[model samples]
Target chain A: MESIRLFCPATVANISCGFDVLGLCLDTIGDEMTITKTAQKGIQITRITGADLPLDVTQNVAGIAAQAFLEQLGTDQGFAIEIHKKIKAGSGIGSSAASAAGAVFGLNALCGNPFTNKELISFAMKGEALASGCEHADNVAPALLGGFTLIRGYEPLDVIALPVPSELYVTVIHPQIALKTAEMRAVLAPEIPLKNAIAQWGNLGGFIAGLYTEDYNLMQRSLSDKIVEPVRSPFIPGFDKIKETALQNGALGAGISGSGPSIFTLNKGIKTAKKVAFAIAENYTETGIPFEVYTSPINKSGVRIINR
Target chain B: MESIRLFCPATVANISCGFDVLGLCLDTIGDEMTITKTAQKGIQITRITGADLPLDVTQNVAGIAAQAFLEQLGTDQGFAIEIHKKIKAGSGIGSSAASAAGAVFGLNALCGNPFTNKELISFAMKGEALASGCEHADNVAPALLGGFTLIRGYEPLDVIALPVPSELYVTVIHPQIALKTAEMRAVLAPEIPLKNAIAQWGNLGGFIAGLYTEDYNLMQRSLSDKIVEPVRSPFIPGFDKIKETALQNGALGAGISGSGPSIFTLNKGIKTAKKVAFAIAENYTETGIPFEVYTSPINKSGVRIINR
Candidate 1:
């Protein structure tokens, strides 16, 4: 087949205790892209929908990802992708990564699936790096591989797809306000206290154990952010109150999702997820700020071919 | 049931990436202690063996642990303990922790296990605090509860016992050279760079995931000390060469066992564990330095009563 259509779901990264290292994909809210072969001997962005992002082939996330992957393939065969995004940009929900990972994933299928998942992630990171001046696999890894993920290291690029508890439900509340990723990262201290670093690693270990063993209480206890959120929460308004309400309303634990403006609560069931969404919505709805909430079980299959 | 005979196993704290928050118990080496109910109305250190540890109830690790426990229990019943140490002190193999944890484990069992594991760890920390000028539960928690463990938080004393892979093996080599724990800790920097801390946490998350999923390659990849070992490894003689030899000779990964001098390597089977031990031992024996080696599977049952 010379053409493929795919859906790459949104991702929630930096899961509180696991800043920049852990992430989970969502079942809803994604970017759909169609990759088609063209007579032209180069990769290009044919169309972009739902938001006014860059349209130039060299400047777009999808275009960059496609160009990188096709270069790796060493092929003169031409390809063009049309993207329809449902996830909002700069929402701390890996919206940009959805476009990047989706293009690579869809293009790989059109090229007969020559590359591995890790390679696809490598190609996809070019898009994120071009946009943010850094390469982060936390969002794109899960968005491509699905489920819970741990980007173990970067020197050799270790990425592992971790097990996700079947009962886990995610509720993401995205406030309309945009928090630039660069500015969100700039708020963090360059050096962390040794004690705090130790605590963070401990929580990360326990959190991973909870995911594999399906220990809900352990996961809740391990959901603390002793490092990242404390430093960056000031950028997101009403962060503490929404988190407290989410935790009090039967949600297991809550924290700022990804970077800022989007807060997420984890729960044991969909009902609790909906309850948390309403409770968190109560904090933002009356303030005349436009917001979006998405509830989903942990996404088991990340980027998939929704249409052939 | 006036007296009890129990053994507390040696432990390897700082499990590479975990720093002060992760550890595991070893089956081969330990401190054997017999705790007896006495007619006297106080805790006492009656007999000590192997190393010249302080015997005073206030200054001794075992005595401090027992005193703290009896005080918290608030009972008029008195207790006396006799310790026979097989693990070497100042060797980076948790010899002191064996005494401290053994005292609490034996006394609690003699008292019909009144306190929970967390309480036992709390009681045990007093012993370490009195000896080291700080309270650390990495070694004691795993020694008391067995298997791999994560001390997620310290303010409220949160400890979680993690699962160990059935096929995992530990090889510990203790060189006769003495490097005090205080000196070892002194070598470490007070603060860690944010990038290094991120890498450490990432490895820790992957390590825990590998444990639960029984992924050996991931565990081997994750067994990296991005924080402590890099700073403290200089204190241990032939550290790099020995670790390189072990890794080359079928060991999964190798690092300083606890603080200094002693080096531990993890592998899949007893044969490889033996091979790695010999390979590492070759590095020390040729230098005319006295060293002891112990190999065992991951201890599932930590402190246990031999003759109940």
Candidate 2:
């Protein structure tokens, strides 16, 4: 093959009650990576796009993923990686995950689909750990495989594919402020209350059940997080107002995307999607935060190449 | 109304991983309670069969619920409660809840439907709290109103009626041994490992999703509980064998019912239900434990007046 162009969709990890366990891939917004093979011994410089991404191979997420991929495969063959970042960084939208997943997925195909999707997810999560200082597969797995995904256990990475209903629409809003992943992690308490923990599990159970059964009401009721969202929402301006407005408009539930700065609402359909997007946009306008709105259907298909 | 006779179905409270949150009402087997207005100053109970039940108005399970009902309504007209027990006590099958729910439901109708179902459930749970020392609404809610139920929160007691798929079949095996609720609670550690907690939540999510969507595979995968089951399974004889046999005989999932001695299996159809029941019986027979099996569907209508 001459070259392969791969797109890895943005994901909302933890997904309200599903902290570090559940996630879903959103269509229409993500990062793209182009991989090309060469007979040379060393990896070549990569083209970078969207919001002035780092060109240094060590600092660039896509480059690190490519290096990790080659190191894991014990391959000396040179490869050229081009990163076209469509999803904004520091937006709580799995921007780094998209690049890592895209690179791993792209390189896997470029090197002859050597690993399973689960393996690629694990490999890409290393890049996430490098970026975020902690390894979590919720974003990486969903970005790679799509749909409703669960990472039950990390070692050997038990990735279970949860059924995603067709009626679900995601409205994502990215405010112009950068929330560093490390800082986000720092603000979160290491230990959560036992009561909150129980309630969290209860909601998570209902949420997963909603995913499998497509019970919209249960999904709505279960899409609540007392642990992370309560602490993280205050950091984002108009987070509470935007979520309330989105829900009032038509969204079933809304919460901070991944960590913070980016907020997302899970809505009923295309109309609700539009309404939710408008609601978030309205909040951002009032708050004087520059924002972009994305209304997309949940992409069940994760990291795959459009042009190979 | 001269008199009302209702069948209050058996229920599984705590639902393994769900613990005080989820419950399901059974169709085929339950306790029958009859309430009639009388010219007495307080409630009177007559337990015809089942366990050595209390008959004093203050001490009786049904009588306490009857008292709560009257107090909540600000009336002191006496009622005669006749409980025809079909679900035996110490069966891990909500025998007390059936009595409590039946008394509240049957008396509510006899008193011209004095309170809503939610209010009646709350009144009945006081009786359950008197019996078990905790205000658990799991069994009472489902016993009063059939189908899968969630007690999301219990300040005012937010009861969510979950969707029950038509294909779900329940096979319940009641071993002739008693597992006290207090002992069962004591058996579980106050604190669990964070990893196990995550797994429990994932499984709970999967189980709930299974209930709504009827995803058999997800249900099976998510049915494995590391926390409650491991800690409490040893209390029930032949739990391991019965669970294994039930799953082997085409059960989607199987676990100890409530506090234990009763084990139930979720199956797809009558065939699987019968097979599951037979498997449990066979496993128990080998262990020399006399067990009773009931194959039933999800009872959509709970606490019905079977006679008047």
Candidate 3:
């Protein structure tokens, strides 16, 4: 294929009780990108629309990730990329991850699929670092491999693709406030109580098990964050009321999505998810902060080809 | 049934990354107990053999568990209990849990099972508190429910039974040394580094995912302890060498069983488990400490009737 148009998914990271390690893909929200082979031997960001982002090869997440992929592949083949963003920057819903994962994914596909989707994560992580100031896989992994992704470890880059329940739906509301990942990370303490840590891991285990069994109630019970949410939620306007309203309106569980200004809830069906979206939207209207609410099914396929 | 004789399986708690929350039951290593309904109006420890333990109802773990069960049942009918112990107390192999769980299990059977195995965990925990100075359900949950268990929360006592791989085997080495759980707990700081906590939960989520999928490689990678093992392993002599030998001999993973003095390794089959057990035994013999090693399959039935 001379050119590939791809749909790169937005992801929800820092899931409740799964902070820093777990994330899932979304079906309805993403960025569209096209990668075309060029005669010149280097990466290029030819165009971007719908968002103000750097176009420099060194500064762009997609450019950085594409550079890392080609460098590893030892290819002189150049690629020109264009991104049409739909997910907002700094929305805590893996905006940069979609671009990064999409670049590597499209490149691998055009390069005769030299790398598996799992193999593409590290290359994507390089771009992720440019955006988050750290080489984190929580967002990039799910955006690459789809479904629920558990970052088992980072040193060797072990990422596991977890099973997704058939009926799981997500409701995400981005309050359009700028919450930098670095700034939000600085608010967390370097140390945590051992008891709370135990509770956190326990709930994580339960949540994973619930996903495999499709037990919504167990998932609800396990979807709690004791360590990170309490400190970061205060920064987001009306975080408490939004979460409480979501739960009351039939969300299986609700919490601050990623580092806040955005909140998410998992529901069993689309009907309840939309209800939760409407209720949360109504509740947040009082805060006088403009926000976007999205209701989507869990995306089984991460990055996909849109057109050829 | 007027009288019942049962086998209460031994359990291994504090499973590597699952510290303070995960555990599994054993098939061969356990205790035998007999409980008989009597005309008397109070619980009694009728006889004890194979281990020196108090026969007093209030002081004995079995008695405390039985009393808890009876009080919850609101029964005035008395029962005579006798325990034939095989698992040594303070072995970090859930010896106390065997007795505690066995008491409630037998009483429930005689009383037509007023409480389920999951429900019996709380009653068994009452007895466990006397042994560990804290009410912990890690061991008792697995011992009562049979197979692997996760203590998701302590406030409302949510214990989840996880799937056990059919080929999974366990090897445990009990170094006959006095290491109290409370003392071992003291060696740990009240707080832990947030980075390590993140690594811990990541591995825990991976391990649970591995169990559900039966991926041995994933299990091996995930069965690691970062927070507790470093500080507590020193208390167990030949800890590093034993773990290395077990891993070298094809054991999936190895770590301290509970608090200290006992170490356990998981293997795919009985042959590998026995090989790992022999390797660990040889490695520990140099310490000149008397130790007993046992290899067994995963117990599916927590406590079962032997005779009635």
**What is candidate 1's CA lDDT for residue A57?**
75
- What docking grade does candidate 2 earn? acceptable
Model 1 chain A lowest lDDT segment of ten? A280-289
Model 2: lDDT of residue A220: 88
lDDT of each: 0.87, 0.81, 0.93
Q: Score the docking of each candidate (DockQ).
A: 0.86, 0.31, 0.95
Model 1, B201-246: lDDT tens digits are 9998888888877899999999998788888888777888888999
Summarize candidate 1's per-residue lDDT along A1-308 as a digit string, tens digits.
27888888999999898899999999988888888888898877878899898778789888888888988899988888888988888898898899999989887887788998778998899898877779888899999999988899998889998888888999999888978889888888899888788888888888887887788998998899888898788887777888888988999888888987799889999899999888888877776778888899998879999878
Candidate 2 local lDDT, A138-160, one digit each (tens): 78899988998877665446787
**Candidate 1: segments with Cα more than 4 A from true spot:** none
- Candidate 2's displacement at residue B261, Å, is 4.0
Clashes of each: 0, 5, 0
TM-score of each: 0.97, 0.81, 0.99
Candidates 1 and 2 compared by DockQ, better number: 1
